[model samples]
Target: MSPVVLFDAALALGVLGCAALALTLRDRTGTVAAFMLTGLLVALSWLRLGAPDVALAEAAIGAGLTGALFLRGARRLGPLRARPPAPAQAAAAALGAAVLSAALLWAFATAPAESLYPPRVAAALEDSGVSNPVTAVLLNFRAWDTLLEIAVLVVALLLVMTLSPPRVIPDKLGALVQPFARIVVPVAVLVAGHLLWQGAEAPGGAFQAGAVLAGAGLALVLGGVRVDRRVLRRALTALALAGLAVFTLAALASQAVTGALLGYPDGQAKAWIIAIEGALTLSIAATLCLLFTGYGRRSAR
Candidate 1:
């Protein structure tokens, strides 16, 4: 047996074990932890399968950010009090999981050899000017997907703002976390910028960069670095709208001048892509920060 094959087989087994443990874990905290572990393991599996981009995504957005969200939710929900599962219910859950797993394994083992769309994507990439097919697909061929994803983010922020109750900062928590925020926020900003720039040809991108920036902003808020409401609100709203507005305008201009939406005039594709990505980076950052902080008026102490 080859070492590569042996390693892949081990990773596959490990992923299955983690999945089963996550499903069967009685404690909510443990379940969340297991899920996070599974995400990390899945990232490793992606690396083993020669998908480094996917591994980066799984590690960052899937494992790190999702785990942070889960931990925060778990904290809000407080300590879990375990309840015994009824035998019949447990049996049914197990049966459902087993059936689902079997179906997934069968599909993986029996799927057809050829993909339906890869060739079409490759054929279109020359016109898009991005060497990476995924990048071309995301930013050029299927730019609409990116546009709609930004819209979904906006809707999510609006929903959170509408649903969250008004909160007054507690003095104790504010005092405790402020010092750490002072040190971390600037570092986070730097990291976000690097990620955004690196995303042009690397694994990092607007979404990941924005999330990191938002994390910093959330830290500042939690630490009671008071925000100027009018400034923050106006700035955030503009940033949130900038990506979509810029992209739409670019697409419309292209259509008028070149006859197709988002179809750049000769030699302008790279410029347009970079411009759109810059706007997207800023917009995504602002939206994520606002969503985390919730809508509120902040005044200096």
Candidate 2:
């Protein structure tokens, strides 16, 4: 068999295994784990298809960040006990899922290869000054998508905040974790910075970098590194709005200079994109950290 055929078979098997595991898992946490695994496999498939940008996004946002969110949600919901589904309901659900999946597969398989937006995207790429076409699409040609995605993130954070239970005091950690966390957090932040900066020309970006930083912050919280409530709250709010605020301001300013929102006039496109991405990275990190920590007063050491 050809290598391509072997690879395709392996990918298909992996995806099927994940789907089966996800369906059979009784525990919510286990199901989420399966889902994340599925996402990782899908990302690998994307890479095989020669779409590294999509693969990066799938691995980072689809698998990593989303898995984190699901795990956090499961933790908040507490112990999971699976209730046996009624046979009829289970059958109905299975049928529906099968039908939907088949329809989707058929549609995709039959769809034309031609794209209406590619020419426009290609034309804008040179002027956008972004090497990656995906980046150019998100930040330039169709910036509205990026702007809306930011709004969605803000809404998600707000929803999490609203639904969160009242403050629960955290357990006092013994001395061992604090020193380790202190050292690790700074290193993680440094890594996140590198990822964010390199995103312009690489696979890492604001979302991925932010998630890495947030993961670091989450470690600190879990390890009982002290955080003042007032400080944390203020920081969370600011970071939550930072991306939207920066993007909005940039758009408004661009209107006057370029006669188009988010259109950078002259050669300042790269600078503008970097500035927005930096702020977005910070905001995303803060929001994810806060979401993981839940609503709580952090003890000030």
Candidate 3:
């Protein structure tokens, strides 16, 4: 086999192995670790498929943030004493998986050889006002979809707040942690800004940039950097809601200006997209951080 094929085979095997390991591991932490590994491998798969944006998202949010959340939950759960599922349940699951796989394969085999959307997108790209096709698609061609996604995040944040999950405070890691945070957090911020700025022309965008910022926030939280709770709460709330609010307002404004929802005026699409993306970056970052931290630390009664 060619080197590329060989590498792909290895990656595919690694993904499957890690996924199986995660499912079967008795230890919660080990299972979470394995799952995270699987996510990273999946991110690599996305890269192999020529989707760097998806890969970045998979690595940052799927693997990094999700793994941290799982780790925190695992620590709280303490011990694992649950019995395994019955044999019948396992058989049913296996049968379901087999059926789904067969159906997907069939669909793929029967599908049209060429997609119609690519040409449509390419034709409309000049008017979309962004050099990056991905950005144009996301922020212009299908902005309604993006709007709904932001709304979903807002709903999730509301749900999290309603449930009021307990906080897991990080233990101090010593003097080294402060120095580490000082260096890493600033760098993460810069990286996030770069990603946001380049997203209109490259693989980086609001989601990826926001996730990076959230990662930095997580580092600070984990590093035991102290902040005033009331102030932090207000700031996070504002930042978390800002993106959706701005997006909504923009949509309305666009409607008023162009007579179509989310439609930008001629020669102004890029400006609208950039403004919306800027707000989204901060909002997504704050929302993710708040979600992971369970809306910040609270005093234990």
Candidate 4:
């Protein structure tokens, strides 16, 4: 077989192996580490599939932030003490997994060789007003879906708030953290901006940009940065809601002008998309940050 095929096979195996290892590991930290490794492998698979946008998201949110969250949960839960699975239960699980794998392989082998949607999307790209096919599809061809996704995020934020989880106070790592944040945080902001702007024509978008900004915020928290709790809370909540509010208002404006929700005027699709994406970036960043740090106020350190 070709080297490329060999590499692909190894990556696929690595993902499966890491996932299984994560599930089998009794130690919480080890399991979290294995899961994060699996996410990185999945991100590589997405890149190999020619979806860099997905790869970026998988790396940032899937591997990075999600791993952090898992670590936090593990810390809170303390040491693992659960007994190993019974031999019979393990055998049954193995049998069930084998059956599911076989079914998936059979479906993949039987799947059609061609799909009709790509050509349709390409044909509509110019009308959608974005050179990037993914962006066009997301912001124009299927905008209602994107709008609903934002609404779902908002709902998730509300649910998280209702729980009133305690704020995350990062353990002091040393003086190096302050210097690290000073250098890294500014770069993260610039990178997020670039990602948001280039998303119109490149493999970057609001989700990726927002995730990066959230990472920066997490870093600031870790570095023991201080800001007034009241102001920070107000700002975060407003920013968290801004995306849905702006998107809804824009949809209404579009309906007024073109008599269809999110239908941009003949010459203004790009503007509409940029405006919507900007709001989404802020909202997504705030929402993710809030989810991580929680809404509880911590006295300034």
- The per-candidate count of clashes, in order, stands at 0, 0, 0, 0
Q: Give the Å shift of residue 113 in candidate 4.
A: 3.0
All candidates in order of TM-score, best leading: 4, 3, 2, 1
lDDT of each: 0.74, 0.79, 0.92, 0.91
TM-score of 2: 0.86
lDDT of 4 by residue, 157-226 (tens): 8997887677787777897998899999999999999999999999999999999999998898778788
- What candidate 2 gets wrong by more than 4 Å, as runs, is 78-82, 166-183, 296-301
Quote each prediction's TM-score: 0.81, 0.86, 0.95, 0.96
lDDT per residue as tens, model 2, 1-301: 9998998999989988997897687688898899899999999998888888678767866887778767766766776666888999999999999999999999999998887887887886778867677777777777778888988888887886787644434467788778988788899899889887777776677777887787787777768656686787788878788888888888899998889888888788888888888898888888777665566443222
* Between candidates 1 and 2, the lDDT winner: 2
Write one digit per residue (lDDT tens) for candidate 1, span 78-177: 6667686899998998899899989999999998778769889877767775565666667788887887888888788778767763433434573548
Model 3 scores a C-alpha lDDT of 0.92
Candidate 1 Cα lDDT to native:
0.74
Top candidate when judged by lDDT against the true structure: 3
Off by over 4 Å in 4: 297-301
Clashes of 4: 0
